[model samples]
Target: MKISKKKILELLTSGKYVPSTFKAIAKILEVKDKDDKKNLRKLLKELIEEGRIIRDSRGRYVIPGENMVIGDIQFTRRRFGAFVSRDDGEEVYIASDDTGFALDGDRVLVEITGTYRDLPKGCVVKVLKRGRTRIVGTFVTRGLFAFVIPDDPRIKYDFYVPPEGFNGAKPDEKVLLKITRYPSPGRNPEGVVDKVLGNAMDPAVDLPTVIFKHNLPEPGYFPEEVLKEAVKVAKPPTKKEISKRKDYRKDRIFTIDGEDAKDYDDAISIKKLKNGNYLLGVHIADVSHYVREGSALDREAYERGTSVYLLDTVIPMLPFELSNGICSLVEGEDRLTLSLEMEIDPGGKVVDFKVHEGVIRSVRRLTYTEVNRFLNGDNDPDLLKHLEPVKKELLVARELARILRDWRKKRGSVMDISSREVKILFDEKGRVVDILPQERGESEIMIEEFMIKANETIAEIFNTQDIPFVYRIHEKPDPESIIQLKHYLEAIGMKLRIPKNIHPKVLQEILEKTKDHPLHSSIERILVRSMKRAVYSERNIGHFGLASQAYTHFTSPIRRYPDLIVHRLLKKIIEKGHFSPEEIDRYEKELPRIAQHCSKRERIANEAEWDLLDMKKVEYISYHIGEIFDSVITGVTKFGLFVEIPEKMLSGLVHVSTLDDYYEYNETQNILVGKHKKRVFRIGDGVKVRAVHADKTTMEVDFVIVEKENNKNNKRNNSKNKAKKRKKKRRS
Candidate 1:
């Protein structure tokens, strides 16, 4: 059932005094069935006594006015704040002096005293909940009771630690802190150091740990419990089980991925029909065989929801013993797989398809680079000898991929340039040795195209079946961001005439023209970020960015939990032929929470990746703090200009006050105009700057614009302004 605005208002008006009960009210309003209705009502009584909601003495619902609105926080580096009030679709402006104690990303309740563009401006009257207790910080020993300050500057406070709380940690070591005392009602939150990482500079171990701290379950080096469970579970494709399904192990098949890939979730086998249609088997590893519902491993995988890749390291959802060993499709070994077999002609259309359970033996493990080299007619003897058949299939697959890519691009898909991982080679002491971009060759594209094809096809399959499963859907950008981006581009005397609704094709054409145009990379980034975040949801919203009629994450179940759920849901309806509508409804009600959880955790993983890259960049810059570099002004704000050093991905700030002249920001044009010197700096303009400081404690790099003549001219203009001001004051 669709949510009714009247029913929600009634619950809000009813006296509920607790936060948990407010959550219950949300759930009650969302559910369609009779069973879910009972649980929500049971919790309503507890909410009445918690003062979270007030009941007038006359006995009627009197929810706090602040409780009426909820919004996602928009965090800044400053102690100041503003929340994007989703309830009212406005920026809730917060004064720097009024922050009190709330920090970034903390959800809180506020009173909507002012509405700006239908959004609210209000003080955070209460913190509804603390998202997490664990935070990463570095220790400092001063006295018998030392403290640890969080590496995340937004935390605003340090932890107080006794010797025992150090857990064998020494001074200046990086450690994890567990909040022991929260700033309750009116107090500041304090924590005790719980775990000590060996050193502050050890990147190998700490990088993965930071990835785990975000409540994402990591595939441990050795998790014996899950390993044991995986080992005991039998594949049991006995005669009886095999008889119920089709077996296609004899078809020549192969898997193509990165050279370092351990978990092979998808494989391809191809054959040409008499009428020129192609039968392509997109066999995926049947992960559901090993991971059963409610099992220990399943529970852990559910919690993690996706694999996190930080540079060369992988924090997988399943234990390596399973992901890399049992489930991995090794060459020459028979493995169970769930497949989408498709029949398409040379025109690159998916005319017909079937989803089946089967067995397959991969003939070889092929690398993407080798396939690319072969395709370019620059093959070595080894590639020709070993990967010839695979390349043949890839040629046919690429034709299909080309068709698919064109079809989507023509349909308004927002295309993205290939961004490889910035591989940083480090010395034993964690010092950067070299930095280079990872090569994404032909094999990668072919595999990606195939996986996308399978995902979209199965997404339609699920939509037609009416089964509830999580989909990776991208929404359109908010109006504010689009306007901001337009202004930024116009400041450089260029403008993209994007459609008001911003369909994918317009952006794709702009990207195609802007390729390799000096400011291309940064402008592309703005376009990419101008869209709403892609997340998992049960609804088939029709992925705006991908420009697909239906889309999902069907492949890579070994890495992503939503894909695993998709596989299971698809299998139940496709193979089993019948399923409980009630159960799907249950999933429809439940999967949104998991989808929200997975999306948030994915962001945390991304943050960890950027954190590692930035730490490496900081380490890379420690040696060059005083050196000058040529940079492009990628961003300009009231506070500073962000100059991107293209040779290195390090961005530094040229503070507003350091400009040597009085300047005012022109928000409409994304430029800072010097009042006296009359110089202007905006996004995409080239500027030279000298590094002034690199503060590791704050992860801030300060720069001074390096034109001496410009500075001298500005100083002379400033003196003239000062003299004029004095004359006016004297006359007055």
Candidate 2:
């Protein structure tokens, strides 16, 4: 009998059918001919590859269902377990023991066992594909046996190397490896050394190690095709092109950014209208015009999603010819822009607005520091002369920004959450000299308010028109996370009344209450984590954090791909007013995939940036071992108290075993209590700790508590020794 793929699918979908092996399935179908059996095998393979059927570890074929899920598994840094982000928007927790042979980033089939703490728990049934083919690690030898310990903390297992697989790699050296065999029960994965990076402590290898581990694209490197396209498009606007666009070159427009900023993508101008309103012009670089859809530059930017700023290095989303050349809104240069001019009333309402493709010459390029100083009564002759052309517009911009900020606050936006960002200062030799927290001045907030208004105005326009567009959505926090947050707040001696249907206002209120608290920064971070991450989506779900009805990333097109996409869609709307049926269908089909890819890429960039930052923080702290620093208890667990040096924002584990007294963990109160001394350590407690260890490889630090009396004693000892030396000198 001839076997068809449809018949096999029908058999699998039948209520009476049970999962079976290929042989059992063939026998059930009554395939007697050898050719029929071969055909059946091919059909099964096709179905599995198309995700129509799942192949279990025991070589049985089953239909995908509630009991099973497929996703990429990510191991936790703690190595206790892994989480599988399912394709259907659910996350399943897989314990370390139940992971089977699956490694980090592997696409696996998981069998749902039950729920752990309200989250679905599962075990890896089979690995369908490997996410990584190469691994970077440190090679070591133990009694003639060799192994490579993975540099990524998320990878829990070490790969074994046979004698012949060394490839001349010496022990204690950094080496790249190619996996030859995967791990099994009670057996380690095996690999062959591909290449030697360098000695583990060599600073020269640091950049390559991070780049290889995160699969980051090389900085300042572009494909020949991409570079050619960039150069071709990086041209000054012609007179014909300039005539077609609205002329804003004579307007009092300027850009506000950091002193070291190179690429100016956004500029602003404000004017006081006659009817007690403000006319705000937000001009963004027209990156979409230069980077046409389906072009090499466009494809590269979409893949990058956003720029990655790693310390002093930048892995930019677009080539320099575009990002730093034609697309940049440089001072005194006639640049093309997509402008949004909004007439906002005194109540901060955008009563009328127009989106225009325009050309502008930035009258002045202002730095945040100088503008801030000028606003705060600085009257230096040179500074005043430089800002003379656009100073009045800047003042008007600040006034309008204040009104908008107030309007957002009244609408229940979570605006007071301080983002903790540190600037790592480097000396002439590229050594980290100091780390300072980046302060957000009034100018920074003013620019932010203006951008928010512009983004919201654009998003509202497209959403109300029922057009296909990408939105930046921030969903409400999960109920379980809110409950946990309440518990955490109670432990910190704050009481919160959580309603069944919570709103962003409640979180805003919590932040407001904690603004002056000693642990304000820590509490802010916890609240931020408790909320869901903001992501790009084709559906307009609204932005919870900003408390905006409709929001999209319509700014910073030079750096963000989503914003570039928005620019394209806006231009279409501007030209045609509405999409044709075919255009609408095409965008509807493509927008979701584009949104998902861009969101994933953004996450990858963020992780890579944070990884490099953590590495640098550890490297800086390595030189300060044996020094005492004041810290705050950020976390309390049975194993240890996690403390962070507030000044440096460096965290380390204070193991329970090193404590002066035996401590018992109180889960209800989330505190560690000393059994005999009655001393308690909970989140937000101030303590002085001595840095005991710092490991660059693991990116971990260890700290021990220093008693208050001991610190005083050391100070007294130094004073006495100084007096004795002075007396001895006098006697001589």
Candidate 3:
């Protein structure tokens, strides 16, 4: 008696039941039996939920159109939005009026009305789910009521807080508010103050505000149950457990990380094999052994997905008891690890590899700076003492790392593009003292190369076995993005010859061709933005950037949930040699959702980290408001020219309105041309700019052009001529 929803929808759209109510439709469909009628009703409900059919004001079910799509609508500050489909289709634009009560990040059913200037336009028909109920904002109390002004720009309307829900928060203080009622067409959403964060301008409250704004987990507060389990798991492995692992205590294993880094999850060791090959070992802390499946700690870790490292603090996925203690591969401590042994040839090929559980005591805990110095013969007594035992092994590791790097470079055409990551140093009062980039050294690259190889090895092994696994997949870039990139390159006077069969090498070649250009960094960033974002997936789409057929995240289990899952599955495969049918089926059924959840969580963490960095950068730049600095025109848009101060790596906008002459943006040329003066300010042009404004709420900086050097020279020449004329007149 179960009616197919698809059949119901097809019949409704087929026009026979046109404008028919539920009772009439039921009668026409010949559903006389009570059970059959119930099935029909259920089918109708299902169809409605799926957005295939909708009930009109007169209670008749009808299909809106073939263009009806379900997706998450991301609204901008001005109310215009984009509908991001769940199935990864082309985005649909939702005009301000078309977005009916659909807030930012809200899942909704949208019907594509028609094309607007070649872009698909949609209207929100129904809100499937609310993305957020609470928002972090500044509280402003009026006579009888208050409103929370959302910090996120995408939230167009302020949440109205009734007097009772004000929670004693003062005006201008940042507060977290929970929506009591959603906003209708004409009414603003109603909310109540849930928690009062301190003054909005206080430097001390910045991090907390950001954490709340992003719904990031508070540091040091674990669920009581999770904490108890973590505490139990904190103890070092017992002798029995150690006995089960392969002992590598005598190996020259060491961990290289930042000096300020905690929770060291990985260590590396290498030795010269007699056959002219190298034996390299990558030991990762075996967090999966301690965090059991379906346990509170595991659930929490899964929820976090990845550790969020802000400038001064880290919001770890696992509790400190696990992350910084037992799971940390600290020097002189016997830590249990899931180790990867790779026999790499001189050509940087991993000839053979094996994954196994191992027990290792790191001989030294070294920083990248220390290693870099050691390689340069900076033999400080303490550094020498720590590194002397592993000097030969270190030399071998460096050679292998170089070989691997060179091999990767030779194989891929695109030059690896990386920006120097900056760290914000805060004073005791939480004010920014210094913002400096973390120096990249060969030691860092060595570790990176080894990790990449291990990840690839693990992915290859599991992929060939046909097991359900989470892969770090980077798909091919969209054709539209490539087209835009080509136009941008041409605007910059660079010719990019796209191959008939486009691959990573094609993009790599473009980078190589423009390597010496002043706009290389900007071009590289554009190229990166044009590519698809890497995400976790059950499907094995080859990693486009790495040019690898198989790739997965297999290291840092203590910090990354995907790595933890990889560890658990890897351990199972190693033990059983192959997974049973049920095990495979279970993983297949569950991995898609897991991959999606983890990917989403990672994105949230990344966004939150970036936001905090932007806030810190603004705070730092605010001190230099009137100072002029040499900046590069990094981006040109219709509204403004984006400039980057190369020395500080700080970027700000030079708004079109700030220019003395009227400016028109040439979209095709990717430059702004002055209407009256015909002055061209294109990307990559160096100019002096005064730091004009830095706003915290908007997280934006504004810059006005100070006279260019050439202009200053011209003015100097004119002044000299005028002075000479005055002197001649005086003499006469």
lDDT of 3 by residue, 130-200 (tens): 78888999898667778898988788788898889988899999999998998886788999999998888
lDDT for position 494 in model 2: 90
TM-score attained by model 1: 0.82
Q: Worst lDDT window (10 residues) for model 1?
A: 723-732
Per-residue lDDT for 393 in model 3? Answer: 77
Top candidate when judged by TM-score against the true structure: 2
The C-alpha lDDT values of all candidates are: 0.70, 0.87, 0.83
lDDT ranking from best candidate downward: 2, 3, 1
* Cα displacement (Å) at residue 601, model 2: 1.1
Where is the poorest 10-residue window by lDDT in model 2?
Answer: 723-732
Give candidates' CA RMSD values in order.
Answer: 7.9, 7.1, 7.8
Candidate 1 residue spans exceeding 4 A from truth: 1-129, 141-146, 161-171, 198-209, 212-224, 234-240, 576-578, 656-668, 673-679, 690-692, 705-732
**Relative to the unseen true structure, what is the C-alpha lDDT of residue 702 in candidate 3, on a scale of 0 to 100?**
77
Best of the two (1, 3) by lDDT: 3
TM-scores for all predictions: 0.82, 0.88, 0.86
The prediction achieving the highest lDDT against the true structure is 2
Q: Give the TM-score of candidate 3.
A: 0.86
